[model samples]
Target: MNRKAFTLIELIFVILLIGVLSAVAVPKFIGMRDNAKITSELSTAASVQTALEACHGEWVINDAPFVCGNGIRSDSADFNATTGYPVTLGSGDDTPLDKILKNGATVHWKKSGENYYGPASDPQNGTSRCIEGKPCIGKCWRYDSAEGTLKLQTSGC
Candidate 1:
């Protein structure tokens, strides 16, 4: 005969156990935030396809002759003496695909026309050829810089 409160069936069983634990933790936190954004867009398309096959195998070990666009090895890095890759899948900064996968091609990408890609709703008619992927729930990771590809489209999530 001395208790003072909480007995409306223990406040409706603690508000029905906090609405059943927020309805089972909000769809498992929105399915773990869409599986951590498709595992960070599949680890940024496998580190920009291993830095576009190590800058096209260092432009076929530099014997591919002349103009690596910026890099030979000391890492100014931009490749493409006619298909060593990265004349533009744009990683920004100075472009030409971030001069060797800098920032791992920055996930959920963007930049549309000049051809830095991923997550562009539409603006890409400038053409560098091979920009088809449009779907990581935000899409755009299919960059084929002269056959040094990087794919992770995931069909619109």
Candidate 2:
């Protein structure tokens, strides 16, 4: 007639403790995940910037060739003459920025009155600016061809 089962009160207490712990930990874990994403995006942006500079240097060394690899010398049909960068993310065969930032993150472009975004089935054009230095998530990596600048937004992330 000996029973080794735990009491109902003990089981309830254990369940309550688990619930409390989970409630405290879930949000922290989510925040951590978001922070990680932001950090990764920043790193990608830095790498792309470095690559862009290198490409520009090469372009300079070659006496500013009109066409090299996927880069155009002047403001060609697809690239910008001022910065020698692509006008849009995927407009040309394979832009220098594209080769550097391939598959890293979606690249958004900003032109005079036209805008183009990538990785979206129906990318909106000229609707909004992507590199406004705002804190955002999922929309990481913005390339301003006009100024030849690449930025990573992570405030909302």
lDDT of each: 0.53, 0.50
Candidate 1 lDDT over 13-71, as tens digits, reads 99999999999999998766545655555665677677667667766677634433234
Maximum-lDDT candidate: 1
Off-target runs (Cα >4 Å) in candidate 2 are 1-3, 60-69, 73-108, 113-134, 137-147, 151-157
Give per-residue CA lDDT, model 2, range 1-157, as digits (tens): 7979989999999999999999999999877654554455456556667766665665556554454334333435555655565554443333324434555334543333323332211133321223345224335444566666765444321
Among all candidates shown, the one with the greatest TM-score: 2
**lDDT score, candidate 2:** 0.50
RMSD of 1: 12.2
Q: Rate residue 98 of model 1 by lDDT.
A: 49
Candidate 2 similarity to native, TM-score: 0.52
Q: Against the true structure, candidate 1 has what lDDT?
A: 0.53
